[model samples]
Target: MNKWLYRLKHAWAVILGKAKISYVKKGGFSFRDFTYSENEIQFLNSLKIEFLFSEFGEQRVNGGGADFQDKRTRLDPSLTSLRKYFPNAKYTVYSDFDLKIDGVNLIKVNSPVAHPEHPRYGYRTADYFKFLSLTESDADFKCVLDSDMAIVSSDVIALIHLTRKFGFCVPYNDRQLLRQDMIWSQDTQPIEDESLGLGHSYNQSPMTLWKDDERGNVFYKKCAEIMKKDPSRSSLVMWKTAWETGIYPYILPKQWCLCDGNEGLGEEVILHVGHEKIKEYYDQ
Candidate 1:
């Protein structure tokens, strides 16, 4: 399986680089299909920080979907709200509608490639890479957060401070039951990319910080090779590689980074509310 996936990753990367493949949506999360509760939108408005809302997919005029069809409809409320927060912060969104979002600049591409690393079919490191490209002129540092997040006043500053002080920031979460063993051997559970060399921060969503010193283009290209080999093990492989390569300096005991999985600390600013855990948090 790893070998097959590796071959696929290699093929995906090559095809992506050369502009060879077409990005077609199979079933997955689409932001346009999601509705932002007023509370979530209001919370985002309260943050009072300049941020961009990244949206992918066609704009849905009125929400409707075909039954038994994978076709997704558009919802622009998030983008609508994002405009409120970062009005002058280069407001725009991208879609394989025929271009790639590389940070602030949108580049037209012939082929719409899938970034297997991200859960979203169209979202890629390239988009954030594009965001980082704008760092020189405006922001001292940029923090990437997911649209689903409900950003409050504290998060805007806390995330900024974390990245500024630590040189890195991860979601405020903790370790979960590793559904498999941390150390991988074929006899043990299948080992993945973490062994190949990558960062353990893959699980951190909505807020990944890449400094000017770290070139996301180079890092993601190298990491994609490992992800192709084993999609499931990609996170571990990326972490293992990052540690071995020393791409980013470490700050740990793992506690200071705010592991939000098992424990919730009072001071933790951002609330993740991932797709799986959204119901749990929403119900509460």
Candidate 2:
């Protein structure tokens, strides 16, 4: 994408300002909107589902702050919400410190994947551990969301159905245009034969969903195999894998990745709090 064209697209987006998911910003996240049949819920529950979350206790927020590792708390509430909604789903946690949450699979990584000394901040700031679910597990379905996510009130059952129907289910970059470089670098892309670039789904990998079968993980295993070329390009690995598998991504409603930057547009099912902006919960 040319720099000028990208800017023009962004300018048009701001001018149009249309987002699909709307946050019920007055009182609370009304679960009333979730109206599914028992059979539908049962069918969803029957499938093996896994949610991946990571919080490095020792990992500092790139720059200095009063509460550097404050995002650790982000997992508890988000996990609670997920459990309340999707009780049959399995949860996985990857952290450097000891976390004693019941029914949640845990992995101990010796260190955060962040490399602050490196020139590229993507390696330092990217949620690299989240990709572990893709590499380490073989559940029927897998999910990994961003740390900034304050609330996930989306229709989980429907999204699961969509994942089964489609290949990768994820949200769009509604607030801003994510650069192409973040998805794939020209020099370090791992796929030998194909380019790892996506046109329809922007910032889709951060809040993504996919599935595997008895055969094994189709997308992630490929990424793990080629990650050695440059592990820093996590999203690049995913894009490459998706491209090769022909399992293109399904772009969810833009509001799933909504933030303060795009409030008042409509109701939001998934809200990502910057922690730097509101420094609090989704108190609506």
Candidate 3:
């Protein structure tokens, strides 16, 4: 809360106000993602935006395991789309071993948590890098994007707008009903605060938009504490922590930021390549 920092935030607030960004909400629904003025892109590009991605198991490529067999194939296209939105933005990849992707900065860190015995990919333990990068990032706006996805026009700007609007942005969970409190609690809900809200989103996709500010730091610090004890067994941690911290995210509608579990992927969406099952969804 330094005076200069506070003033700087205030100054940005005023500049944003002057930017005259208009939100053209799809279907006129308040909760849905909106299309912004094209002029806003320049201003958005001027900000310090960074895209975070992780490839924990390079060996997954050679394996027959479906969990991440084709994940590496998705990285390049995703990067190309990300670069389109934020032409001068930073791209960071958190990996377990040495990796070189053109125009990407790498942080070779091993998985901090071991996967619990699960027949499935044990995704909870595998996504620790998603938490690690977002928590440690110093960008003005940080986006946690799955390597399998591509960014369409204005999607990046929309995410940043939501983070600034509601303190954070996460895609709406289509299967939110499956997120029983007992189910999540049995899995060891990280920051236990009974007074806070629960199940605002249960998508468990690592995709997110975070602004580097006071509330953002609190959210990251809470995740850091969870990492020490829990260490990203699932994206449920991100969804739950956002609510518990009172930084209830703006739900980027089902059509935009589309993923697996979100069915009926017609030709009316913004982002479609998110889950390992995305290929099947595309085939259908």
Candidate 4:
């Protein structure tokens, strides 16, 4: 069976702002503060399901002073809150140390790439590839999420059913180009493809549903291999190849994910909290 899972890139503040996406702002984060409000608590209690959260770790915030371990700890509330709804649900927090939430295991990716290198290190896609490696052996259906994401109770069931129907589900909207000042290139081919339904758009937020099967592992390995070959150019090559070839058919778009960006303030449907802005969203 095909897996249905959502994925997102945890970008930095500068990157997030430049991408024209909005995010939550609060104090810096600590594991103790991730507590959900009573309303938030009640909402999570309503769902009775299990899901995996593949949160990208602190590497995304290179320049920030926020503590990585604290951010990781802060996620416990969301994990605990999720357990309230998904009793059988387990969480696998990917990091250097193995931790557990409820009965869920926290998988660790001690790969060399996880270490600090240069200013331009740990590309968001690279972290995703590493996280995927950790899940390659699991047997349950997998649902990957960016750490900054919060889902509505209604979307829970719809996502499950939708994934079952379509081999994959992605939230797509008109892909708007970054401002002229932020434009990385004058590439119009992709712009046209986005218009023609031959292109896809997303930060891969709570990109959901992955079957605990070989196909999932195979797909993960394929991505890993591509990055291992040339980590720097893999993203560009992937985009280039996809554009040159008709690859959008492989990705489904029946229920395009919604981004706040569509609403004027540019809410990133998946709220990509940048490193600099971590303090803005969570109490420091």
Top-lDDT structure, candidate number: 3
Which numbered prediction scores highest in TM-score against the true structure?
Answer: 3
User: Which RMSD values do the candidates have, in order?
Assistant: 17.4, 10.6, 8.8, 12.4
10 residues in a row with least lDDT, candidate 3: 27-36
Error of 1 at 212 (Å): 3.5
Model 2 quality (TM-score): 0.65
Instruction: Single out the weakest 10-residue window by summed lDDT for candidate 4.
Output: 26-35
List model 4 lDDT by residue over 63-104, tens digit each.
Answer: 323344454443543454344435555565665544444466
Candidate 1: Cα lDDT at 44: 44
Q: Model 4 reaches what TM-score against the true structure?
A: 0.52
lDDT by residue for model 3 over 85-186, one digit each (tens)? 567888998776777877789887654454445432334434555655676887878877665555544434555666766766566665553245335443
TM-score of each: 0.46, 0.65, 0.66, 0.52
Write the residue-wise lDDT of candidate 1 on 78-130 in tens digits: 23333433443443333335433333444333223334545533443333322
Expressed as tens digits, the lDDT of each residue in 36-77 for candidate 2 is: 344456776777888887666544342211232444353644
> lDDT rank, highest first?
3, 2, 4, 1
lDDT of every model, 2 decimals:
0.36, 0.53, 0.56, 0.39
Residue 133 lDDT (model 2):
60
In candidate 2, the residue pairs with backbone N, CA or C atoms under 3 Å apart (3 or more residues apart, or in different chains) clash, namely: 21-267, 22-266, 22-267, 22-268, 23-267, 23-268
Candidate 1: C-alpha lDDT: 0.36
